[model samples]
Target: MTFSFEQPPDKLTWYHLGPLLDAEAGRLKYNPEQYTVHGVSNNAVACCWAGLLVDGDGGLVLTDLGRSMLASWKASPVGQRWLAEQAALDEEMSDPAAPSLPAPQPEPQRADQLGLFGAAS
Candidate 1:
């Protein structure tokens, strides 16, 4: 299974909650065709590992902890900020102007971001 968002925001895990909230609002569908059978299965299993959802007769069902946590988070300022940041990231991976490529003489390369998580690519 993959951690959809390898890096969480504000250490509050808004990425995980966003999906649960979507599920609560009936926007998240468990249709395997939409996200492949393994994708759907992997996501549900990952959510279960996060303790925010569980396997149900129909599909993955959000847990009580997930709901309560989302509610509590929304009531706090930090949580609000996190949500805003998450919204931005979800909206676009890159925005505004980007730096021009280095001149013919390039700079040293940086290590793979995923390397930090033991999943180098």
Candidate 2:
């Protein structure tokens, strides 16, 4: 089926994607039109149209477009924040000595400000 990425019904989130991701990653068998996320059921057609999945002789497979889209979503500001939080949790689980937080990213200076409190030069 054909679908456009210009505007999707939902903004993809990390939540409710475990099944689909697992299927794509080969962790689970693809069972076409038999997955749900956040109480909403997903079908192969919808996924294929969204570029998140493709139909193959075997079953369904994740496409490069889907992978890239997911990566892009995860790299967004909000996504980055989530990543930091997950990293913190993972650190706690794997090694207590590791830093609990990600390095702070400096905020961009306002156009009116120069260095610190100095006026724009």
Identify the candidate with maximal TM-score: 1
| Candidate 1 RMSD to the correct structure | 11.4
Off by over 4 Å in 1: 1-11, 39-44, 82-121
Local accuracy of candidate 1 as per-residue lDDT tens digits, 1-121: 3233332223336346656666667555567786775435454455566666655555566667656766777778987887798888866656556455666843345345435578545
lDDT values, one for every candidate: 0.60, 0.59
Runs off by more than 4 Å, candidate 2:
1-10, 19-49, 55-60, 96-121
Kindly list the per-residue Cα lDDT of model 2 for residues 9-101, writing each as its tens digit.
Answer: 356664425534655566544444554441223544466656676655555666776666667767789878876997888778899676667
lDDT of 1 at 116: 53
